[model samples]
Target: MDRVDRIRERKREHLELALTEASQSRRASGWDDVALVPSALPERSLGDIDLSAELVGHRLRAPLLIVGMTGGHPDARMINKVLGAVAEAHGIAVGVGSQRAALEVPELAPTFASVRDHARTVPVLANIGALQLIAQGERPALGAEKVARLVDMVRADAIAVHLNVVQELLQPEGDRVTGPLLPALAALVRVAPVPVIVKETGAGIDRESARRLVDAGAAALDVGGVGGTSFARIETERAGVGEGPFADWGIPAAASVLECRGLGVPVIATGGIADGATAAKPLALGASLVGIGRAALLAANDGVEAAILTVGRLIDELRTAVLLSGGARPSDLMARPPVLTGATEAWARQRGLLA
Candidate 1:
């Protein structure tokens, strides 16, 4: 099959695999170890709590971002439309899956562009893979210019350069590279019209890598940590390779949030964030936003109205968590602080991320 055909097939497979009974099975997100301190006297009414937040100049009604999942297929048009409409109604941001396939095939552009068509106001992030950018090779400036066009294709508020080395290694068709990724990312950040966000695919970003990406000019970070969707397991299954120990690889989302804290940039805590309480823990760990992936995808599978209601329920849960924690606003939840324990605390200490 041709590149475009491969991209299209991959999208279909991803969607099919994502909605599987096995895919919906729970995985560890590591948030369980981070305990939010409860207030005996919250001193505030739940109705007064504000979930509003601002990121890269866009004001969100809530700090929840519907993370990128799929695109590059005909079915993606309906999915993006549903997700975009839900985001617009909820006043939150939504991201499209990697635009590489669409970029490779002009005819497929509409699959990703449909997002901008539906989400007229909220932040819409365009995605590209880091390895793909590096593979363009020798003409860094040219690659950056092409990425800029991708942003324009969707009128994206920000562009997310996703890092998925583990996923790539696991995939039979994956590319393995030993060279540096920062220089290429830096080149893209310099010329892209919108802010560039460096995100992990599933295996989370460590403090060292996070620092380097920030230095390379990333405007934000999405620590797509482990304990959520294990791409290793997914790809292995898709490849018919059966199960392996690599399925549980990478840092957990909670530990990743702690590692990336105090880095002077906004952190989006994702991976295994299913409900409001789980989402609230990331804020206390210094994440500016929380991301939901599988949960949102499952809801979207049920239809647009189902997706909206699902997201609404999560927001309601987050608000209740804030009130119970003595926070009158989403921002206040950050100040409440969480007690870190178990593997999460040990991971932080071992990495020198904690005092």
Candidate 2:
């Protein structure tokens, strides 16, 4: 098969693999180790609690985001439509999966563009792989122009450049070069029309990497840490290999959130955020927003209503978490301290991220 066919097949494989039990992480996201202090008397009404959040200059009704998942295939069109509609209905942000396939084969553009068509109001983000940009050769300026076209294709309010070295290493046809990344990312950030969000794909960014990306001009960070969908496990299954040590690799989502603290740019905590209570922990840990990935995918698979209800329930749970923690708004939840324990505490101390 040609590269276009290979891309399409990979998209299908990704969706199918994501649905399997093997793709999920066996460990905790470390949210269990973080506890929010409860209020004796919250003083604020439950109805008064606001979940509004600002991302890349767009105001969302809630601090929740539906992270990128699938595209580059015909089936993905419907999936994006459902996710985008759900996000639009809830006044939240939505990101489409990588547009490389669509870029390579213009016919697939509608698969990603359907997101913008359905979700016209809320912030819709365009996505591209870091390696894909690198593969475009030495001209960083040329890559920037292509990325700008992707933004226009989806009318994206922001663009997410995903770094997935682990996934690439595991994939049979993955790109292996690690050099020339920072400079290329810097060039893209400088020329891209919209705010650029540097993101990870299941292998969380450490403090040093986060600092470098920020320095490279990333406007935001999406810490796609561990304790969630294990891309390693998915790739292993795809390769017909049983579980391996790599399945549980990468920095835990909670630890990654701490690593990104004080970086100035807003952070979107993702990976293994199963429920609303767990989702609230990251906000307190300094993340401006939280991303629900596998959960959203599973819900979308069940049906559009199922997806909407899933998101709605999480939003309700987040609001309840805020009220119980004595906060009147989702943003205020960040001020309320969390008692860190277990491996998360050890990680914070080891990384010097703890106060």
Question: Pick by lDDT: which candidate is best?
Answer: 2
TM-score of 2: 0.96
> In candidate 1, what are the lDDT values of residues 1-355, reduced to their tens digit?
9888888888888888876744432456679899999898898887899999977899999998888887889888888888898999899999999887776678988988888898999999999888876653342423766787799989999998889988888888786763578898998888889999999978889999999999999999999998887778778878987766677678889999998888899999999887998899999888999988888887888898988999999999999999999989877877767888999988888998874
Residues 95-198, candidate 2: write the lDDT tens digits: 99988778778989999999889999999989988877665344343465687789999999999989988888887777777567898899888888999899
Q: How accurate locally is residue 90 in candidate 2, as Cα lDDT from 0 to 100?
A: 95
Q: Which ten residues in a row have the lowest lDDT in candidate 2?
A: 135-144
Residue clash pairs of candidate 2: none
Q: How high is the lDDT of residue 257 in model 1?
A: 94
After best superposition, candidate 2 residue 99: deviation in angstroms?
0.5
Query: What's every prediction's RMSD, in angstroms?
Result: 1.9, 1.7
lDDT (0 to 1) per candidate: 0.85, 0.88
Give the 10-residue window scoring lowest on summed lDDT in candidate 1: 135-144
**Global lDDT for candidate 2?**
0.88
